[model samples]
Target: MLKLLIAVIFFAILLSLAAGAGFLIRDQSPSTRLLTSLKTRILLTALLMVLLVYGFSQGALGT
Candidate 1:
């Protein structure tokens, strides 16, 4: 379950990245969508890092 959550968050970050790229290509002028996407990706990445650390610390995830 925890692993699934991590994967979902990771995918969300990827999706945000793609969206940002699309926004960059579609919008010639300054846009808020790209900035929002970047912010979302950053937050999701931080969340993923925190979850990974907690999972490892609790022995819920490991090799």
Candidate 2:
């Protein structure tokens, strides 16, 4: 269940990144949406890293 949740969150972050790139290409000027996406991605990445570490420590990620 935890792994599934982590995968979903990671996929969402990737989708957000793709959307932000699309916005950057379509818009004439820089927008807050892109920055917001970037910040979100960064935060999500950090969270994911923590989750990975915790999972490893708990022996949930390795055989």
Candidate 3:
């Protein structure tokens, strides 16, 4: 359980870092910058949440 939580935390951090890189490194099209940023944030948040849920449900970790 502790391990799973740790893993999830690490994964979330990695995802956010990658998203930050994407925002920092890419030249987004003017038409899509705002949308892309919003999408990235949403996906990051959702991915973390899903990981948490799955880990907990699978008994890999306690919520």
- Clashing residue pairs in all predictions, respectively, total 0, 0, 0
Model 2 agreement with the true structure over 1-63: per-residue lDDT tens digits: 779978988998899899889878887875688888888899888988998899889988879
Q: Quick one: best lDDT, which candidate?
A: 1
Q: Each model's TM-score, in the order given?
A: 0.95, 0.89, 0.47
Ranking by lDDT: 1, 2, 3
After superposition, which runs of candidate 2 have C-alpha atoms over 4 Å from their true positions?
none
At residue 57, give the lDDT of candidate 2. 94
* For model 1, the run of ten residues with the poorest summed lDDT: 28-37
lDDT of 1 by residue, 1-63 (tens): 999999999999989999999999999887799999999999999999999999999999997
Across 6-62, the per-residue lDDT of candidate 3 in tens digits comes to: 567667667666766676667565555545656766776776678777778888776
- What are the clashing pairs of model 3? none
Whole-model lDDT per candidate: 0.95, 0.87, 0.67
Q: Which ten residues in a row have the lowest lDDT in candidate 2?
A: 22-31
